[model samples]
Target: MILEPFPPALPYDFVFKLARDSHDLEGYHKLRREIFCEEQHVFETDDRDLFDESAMPIVCKSLIAGMEDTVVGVVRIDERSSGLWYGSRLGVSSGFRRLRHISPGVAVRNLQPCYAALGALGAGLIYKAVSTACALGCHEFLATVQQQNARFFQRLHWQPLENIMLHGLPHVLMRADLNHYAAAKKVA
Candidate 1:
C-alpha cells in the first residue's frame, strides 16, 4: 500500500488528552474491534474485561472533523511494581489497516509500531501508566511482545528475554530501559 503524507497538524486534531468517559466508550470499542478482532484475529472477544473498570484511555483527533474528531488511536496500560506493563488493542485506521482492517471484533493485527510511539509521546491510554511508572522511578518497562512483533520491538531497542505463550499467542518477554531512551536527544 502506498503511504500518503498525512498533515501532522490535521492528524493531531490540534489536541491531546484523556478520553471523556463511558460516553465515547462505544467508539473506543468500535476502534478496538476493527483492529484487534477483525483485522488481526486476536481474540474471540467476550466484550467484557477486568480493565474496563480501571484502564485509562487517550484519543487522537483529526482537525477536518468537529470536536469529537476521530479516535485515531488508543492504548491500555497495566501499572506494576516491577515496571509499567502496557498493552491494548489499537487501530491506526486511516494510515494503515487498508479498510479490511476494520473487519469486526475477532480478527486483526496483534501488534505494531505504534506501541513504542505511544510510550514516547506520553499519548494514548498507555501514556498515563508510563508516566506513573516514571514517577515511581521505574527504570525499565516490560511486555509480552507478540512473536510476530518481536522483530519490530527489537528494531526499537526493546530486548527480548524469553519466548512464552500468552493469551493463546506466542510472545517474547521484552524489556525497555527508559533511562537509555531518556538520554537520547529528541529530534527537532
Candidate 2:
C-alpha cells in the first residue's frame, strides 16, 4: 500500500518489513556502496558493521509502477542496548532521482534533490519504528550518523548527544526521544 512517499510527490511504495536473510545481503551492500561511496564522496570502504548482520532491511518500490517495480530506496534498523535504532547507508537510487532545486546542471548533483525527498520518507518510517520500539519497552531511538549528515536529523529535531571520531572520519551519536515519537503517533 502507498503510505505517502513524500509531501506532494510519491516516488516509491513503502514496505515496512525486514530484509531477506543472507540472500539479500548483497543487494543491501551494493546499494550502500553506490549511494554512499560512488554518489557521495564518502569512504569507499565497505560500510558494513557488526549491526549489519542483525539489522533488517526495508525497501521502497515505485508507487506508480509497482517490486517487479524498481527498488528505489533501502534502510535497515539495528538495536543497540541503548535503545532500538537504525543506521548506516540509507539512500535513493539514481533512476528515481527527483529533479528539482538540486538538479543543477552538474551531473553528480542531479540526484541530490531526489535524495532530499528521502528525509520525509525516513522520518515517516523511523518514527513508526520508534513508536513500535516504545511499545517494545524502548525508551529512546539512537543512531550514529556521519557528522556531515547531522543536518538531516536536525531537521527532525534530533540532537547530537555524543561526538565520535573514528577511522579519521567524524560521526555523531544522535538520540531521538521516543516519548515524543509516540506522542506524535498518538496525535496522528
Candidate 3:
C-alpha cells in the first residue's frame, strides 16, 4: 500500500499591517499584479501608477501557526490632497478567499454566499487603510469600487457619491464615513 502525505492546514487568522519591508512590499506588488493584471486583465503588464510613489501599501498576511505566512490580501492608501485620502488596488488571493465560511446571518443581496467570506477579508483591509489614513490626519477617505461590490462597501459604512468609469469598467465613487473608523495607532 502506498501512503500519501497530508496537505498543510490553511490559515484561518490574518494580520493586517502596513508593508514595512522589502519582503512585504514585494509580496504586496506580486499579489496586486496577479489579481489586477493576470486575473482581471485590468492592466496588460503592471498596474502601478503615479500614486504608487506616495501610496502606503497595506497587507493582509495569513498566519500559519501564529507566524506570518503569505500576503493573501492587499490595498494601497494615499493622500491626494490636504485631508482627502483614497484606497486603491484592493484584492485578495483567489485561493485564500475561500478559506472561510460565511457566518449564518451575513449576506449580501443579489450576491453569492461566497462573497460574504470575501467581504470579511475585505473589511479588515479596508479598516486598516481607513484607520491608517485617519491616523495620518485624513478627514475624508474614498475609493472607486467595482459596481458589483458597491453594496458591500455600503454595508461597511461607505456612501456612494457618484458613478464613474475607470480602467475600462464601471465603478462607483464612494467615501468612507470617518466617524465609523477610529484612528489607528501610529505606525513607524
Candidate 4:
C-alpha cells in the first residue's frame, strides 16, 4: 500500500505579546515588508519610517506543541506626544491570515477563512497593540488604516476621524475608544 506524506503541522495555538527579542522584532519587520511593500506595493522598497524608531512592536506568535514557532502577525504602537499614541504597520503573514482556527479533523488544505472574524489572528494583533498602548497611558489612540480596513477597525470600536491620502492610497484616520481598551492596564 502506498502512504501519503503527512501534511506539515499547523499551529493550533497563538499568543499575542510585545516582541520579546531581536528575532521577534525582525520577523515583525519582515512581515510588514511582505504585506506593505511586496504584496500591496504601498512602498517601493521598505515601509519603515521615523516612527519605527520609537514604536513598540507587538507580535502574534503561532505555537506548535506548546512551543513558539513564528510571528504570524505584527503591529507597532508609538506615543506621538503626551497622552497621544498611534498604531501602524499592522500585517499578518499571508499563509496564516486565513486561519480562523486550527484543530484536529480540520483539513489543512482548506484553511481559507475570513480574517474579519472576532478572534482571528489579525484582530488579536490589533487588540494587543491597542491594549498595550492604553496601558502605557495613552489617552487618545489613532491609526491611519487603509480604506478597505476601515470598517474592520470600526467593528473593533475605532471611530473614523477623517479621510486622507497616504503613500498614494486612500486611508481613514481612526481613533480607538480608550474605554474599550481599559482592561489592558489590569493585564499589564
Give the number of the best model, judged by TM-score.
3
Segments in model 4 whose C-alpha atoms lie over 4 Å from true places: 1-9, 102-116, 185-188
Q: In model 3, what lDDT does residue 112 have?
A: 16
Which scores greater on lDDT, model 1 or model 4? Answer: 4
lDDT score, candidate 1, position 125: 27
- In terms of TM-score, how similar is model 1 to the real structure? 0.60
* lDDT (Cα atoms) of all candidates against the true structure: 0.49, 0.55, 0.82, 0.78
Arrange candidates by TM-score, descending: 3, 4, 2, 1
lDDT of 1 by residue, 1-188 (tens): 99999754333322233566674466667777776777667766644378666655544433344345666565554555465555444345545322221212111111111333323222222333344445545566676767876775575566889999977888898876464343211110
- Scored against the true structure, residue 180 in model 4 reaches a CA lDDT of 70
List clashing residue pairs in candidate 4: none
| Model 3 Cα lDDT, one tens digit per residue, 48-122 | 999999999999887666677899899999999999999999998888665565333322211212234545668
Superposed model 1: Cα runs more than 4 Å off: 1-16, 46-48, 65-68, 82-84, 97-132, 135-137, 180-188
Q: How many residue pairs of model 2 clash at the backbone?
A: 1
Tens digits of per-residue lDDT, candidate 2, 67-171, equal: 333455566666677655555465656654442332222112111112335454455445544554554566667777779778877766688898998557788
Question: Judged by lDDT, which candidate is best?
Answer: 3
RMSD of each: 9.6, 10.2, 6.2, 5.7
lDDT of 4 by residue, 19-115 (tens): 8699988888888888999999999889989998888888878777667778888888999999899999888888877776654322122122223
Location of the lowest summed lDDT over 10 successive residues in candidate 4: 105-114
